[model samples]
Target: MNHLLIATLLVCLSTTIRAATATPPPVPDVEIVLRETQPLTFPRGSRLPLYLWTPNFPTADDAELERVLKALEARGIALFARWGGNDFAKASAFPLRVARLQKKLGLETSVDATGLAHGFYNGTPATGHVDKDGKRFFDKSFFWSPGCPFAVQPRYDAMRARLEPWLEKYQDEQLRLDFWAADWEFDGPNEWNSGWASARQCVTCRAQIPNLDTDFAAFQTAVRKVRAEMQREVFVKPIQRRFPNARIGNYAMNPHDGRRYWWDFFEKRTDGLPAKAEHGALYRPWAREFEDCGYTVAMPVIYTWFNLHGEYPFANHQYRWFYNLLLEASSTGRHTTPAVPRVTFVHWTTTNPPKELPKDFEALTETSYEELLWHLLLRGHDTFAMWCPAPELAQEVRPVHRVYAAALEYKEFLDHGQPVLFDVPKQPGFVVSALQLGKKLLIRRTDFGPAPAFFELKLANGTTLRVPKVDGKCLLLTTP
Candidate 1:
């Protein structure tokens, strides 16, 4: 590859680049492209894609949608609109309308699939309620299951069929599909729910995988193969027929380890995935296959409290694990991986409150918001999604939006990819990581604590510089 071509691809983050005099606050982090590993370009010069959900319920007024869009645009943000599946499945014309508005705002539109198993006569054999081992509970009336008698292949086929015309009409840059809903994932602890890979016992699924035992790994693999075929034959083909340039994606949830209270399934490691894939062993099924079949993956994590603990302990833990998994996935460098790791930060506020959060729990989450932003700034995320909670709690959740707005304003400068040179041999409590984008350098500082560290930066101008902040537990430096 030409140096320019190589620069465009495989942009690495490094720490030892020469710094220039402090100028314009570093160009806003979101617009900074420290590395260009692929031919990826940000629309409107934004780095991270900031998406907000425009749902059908508590229906957003045209004025509200326009207002939010303008706000996001002003802050260098983007939007992702959802079309109802259970309540508005194939009936509402919102997706098309939303797409038109998206085009007007120069925004990329994404459609969400709702009733895979919940709605009537659409597809799959799913009902609003599910029976796990003998106990039963209602699934949020969002998705219809592939196993529902009415769902089967035709039901899913219909979803794709409906999308074809619109996909052609819009030819938007990316598409997102949520084929499975929350009930499918194991709840960790004592919950035995299927987590998206549920319901293989259905007659049609059983007929296909006759010897399918109730093994989590096997069931996951079977579902993966089936879903991929559907995307390839039904969804992808139809979209390609209509618009060949668009990218398609969907959301998946991670399964919790038993110790953390998820319905335990794999006490030992499962099959098909590599041992190294253990960070998020439960959620990688489609992640691996989506890559094989060419699809984008979005993992939505629901941090709902089972018994209403004020601290949002579970949600906090889930967020950390999800972050780790995303970091692992990006570092692996596999394009075939179907999903780009992103977090759909959701807060179920109608019922639960943190027992011991800051007097203002919402404000405390702002710190989390900052941490999340810091992580994304370092890791290079594709998008940041926030889920819509119930109408009553919208006021409380508005702060998150504010924080997102503040973060995006700085995205362009944050993305410039500065270098943090590391002298591995001399550093005692630090480890070095680097990313180089085009002509820029990005170097991260990680201090393991207990001692001092030293590092050197090799700049583009043939000069060597040293990072001076190597004394603390966590140090971050940027090149000028």
Candidate 2:
């Protein structure tokens, strides 16, 4: 009897070990329709910049749509469309038009879907209670409002129902979720101080925190926890399960004021409740979470174009901020997943300067456009997507076209080469990147300052090469 019992225990232990060591099932095979497209190649380790054009699909007529599509394709640009708005059902038909146009033009017609983070309301009765002011809270702007309580089961179920059908229809394409959380900071206007603040007083939300009504800390903690939970469980996990093979990209906002509310809540750490953490410390973990969960791309859309003029004219201080954040995040040994490349989406136009530019600064010049792109490329960003480019603004479009031509001129070197290698003891006002293609070595240096500057490059063989100032900020050199 004793021998039999020992043998049974050993057998059970062997079975448990096998289960633990077994590999997970492979992710479903997803059909990539536009794998050959230029913009689609960036996610697959290509160094080329992915350019996307954002245009309203439902309202665009067939002729106008074709014109825009052809124009963008001529420049190797891809279309990024929003999937879940009030007119989403109607917008579903837009993809068919895009596909047909691509076929007609002999172009790859795959449109990437943009899932607006807070735009998932199905127009049904609430399974949750009303806010303190007896108002229904829904997202009014791109950012999250405290009034919108998305923690209720009914809301999650409704959102899943609405999203699943759309995902099923386009299971083969990539989906990018934008503005994934609230943007609350001291710098911005305090819009949440009114009824929006009391909107979190829903029954389900209140049940999560005992002292939510009286304790401000408790209310903040509860709201953060609910938002993170909804983001992960409702927004992220279900989509992953439904479309196991689709490429999921998240546009996580790197909150400007250094408050990592989502990261703190997700980790259940309340010690630094009200204090601001370093930007890298906050965004790195948030990005890692999505990366580990099979997200192909994660980009922090820095929403501070208005504040750019306050610091330096057309300087793109935000790009430098994001670059430093990426440097800090990578230095820590915690991010074990695949390295996610950086992308910048800048709001640059002539007619509408968000705020007044400095006295000596011009609005939008060819130099400003060129400098921004060069800085992003030198600082380690893989792609740059402009928010909106109005063709009507001929002055602005002309400069943009010039820069686009320059990018295309260097596509062969930029697309096929390895990551940019920077020089040690980096120059103060200049940034340099070197790439070797076969026997030829190409070095590109960009000057960030207003004044033209000269530089020198010393090779390992103790040979020094002098670089001259060009007409523009960027200069590309090839060695024999």
Candidate 3:
């Protein structure tokens, strides 16, 4: 029979784990062994920062839905959110449904207020971007007509109108509205899905903008200013007026890293001279403009876009590169908005995927997927707002649940402890990161390559503890 695991795990670590020759006085040698690792239990007061939000998290009827919800809840998901459920047209239903979810599951809901703001996905003719001919910009693509709307005064008024009902319904405050974010699609001044330069052709552009044809930098700045102001006035401000405690932000609201990455879209200009995506590379970040948006929470969309491999000719990228990208994101958020908490948006699956993986192609393995999850928390982002697929919820997310459950086990260190090692040397065919809490240190070392015989970890107090390898899971250990 499997035995009950206890807090007195040090005894097992001390005895079973093979140790190097000498032991220093203050710090003792130890390594924990996961005997009967199955049926991972949630810590008594689990304050794990892992959140799971499905498409329709709260569907009133089905027994199967409840089963999936309970299973997800059991997986030590500390927070729940509605990624998509309520109608954008009538956002009044949003607050009530979330309230119902909170009452039934006994977990708070992180609101995705995309619809709360008045902007459309692909804005309409009356509201969307209009050229001198009064036609929308980027109005038609091969698959869809992605209309980019300019942030003008009329839309702002409509935003307030749409918000009144949501505001009135949300006054009840039935659920704890802790974290809030908006996945406002086709937002911002861009050359992609929407158009920024197309505004040059706009009649309003001719009137509002000075030297519209020549001064592209001014044009970029102007459009960004209008968009940010709209976001602040329409989405963030109203929510703050009602729910002061809400940690509000918009998705991809982190520090802009310069011009967009290379792709098929408008690579017309090769010279790095102007602040345009067309310029190849020259647009400086609009630091003041980002701050003006008034985001209480810095929500960075840190998805596995490259899992080190996004292109057709697949390449095996190093683990350090991927890990450092996550670190950069977390650090960027902190520097940009030091006062605000970082609630990173994560997707377990690669957002940009190849149509099919060749037999020889090496993408992220299952173990690597788990490691990515750990690194997100290890880098000290407050929590994750995860998006899960609708079908086969339990099985698809079971591995993630394990990672979450494991995280809660050391909630104290994870919450309070600072990361001593961010750039863990990728030597043992695996990657590692360490968190320190006073004398004791907790390490999360996950294997990506072939299983090594053993590896050594040096502590804060100058002690080296050699740890044996574990299979099929993350190797978590604490030094004594």
| Top candidate when judged by TM-score against the true structure | 3
RMSD of each: 17.8, 22.6, 14.7
- Model 3 collision count: 0
Q: Give the CA lDDT, 0 to 100, for residue 201 in model 3.
A: 66
CA error at residue 280 for candidate 2, angstroms: 20
TM-score of 2: 0.56
lDDT of 1 by residue, 1-480 (tens): 689876755453221122233343533211221111112233336344544443232236666666555545555444444434434435446655556566676765555543231222332234222344543233222232223321334545565655454444454544332221111221111112333233443443445454545454555565555455555565556655655545555443321221122111232233433233323333332333444434433444333332222323323433432333333323322221223444443433322434665452333233443433343334444444545443423343344444444434344434554322223322124444444455444444544334344556676677664655432122333445
- Please give the distance, in angstroms, between residue 322's alpha carbon in candidate 2 and its true position after superposition: 12
Q: Residue 207 deviation, candidate 3, in Å?
A: 5.6
The estimated TM-scores of all candidates read 0.53, 0.56, 0.67
Tell me the tens digit of each residue's lDDT in model 3 across 393-458: 443355565666677767877667766555543333655566667766666666655656677777
Off by over 4 Å in 3: 1-49, 61-74, 78-106, 115-151, 173-175, 191-194, 206-219, 255-290, 306-339, 352-354, 358-360, 392-395, 420-432, 445-480
Tell me the deviation in Å of residue 27 in model 1: 34
Q: lDDT tens digits, residues 1-480, model 2?
A: 698998999999999999899996632111011221223222222342344434334346788777666655555455455454556568667665655565677655333444434533433335223556655554333232333344354466665665566656554443332212221121111112332234344655566557655565555544445444555565567666655433345444222222222221112223322343433222212212333334444444422233233333234443332233233322221222225444444445532344556565444344545654554444344554544544433333334435544555556555554433444221225555554454344455655454346566665555565666554544556542
User: TM-score of the candidate numbered 1?
Assistant: 0.53
Question: Count of backbone clashes for each model?
Answer: 84, 0, 0
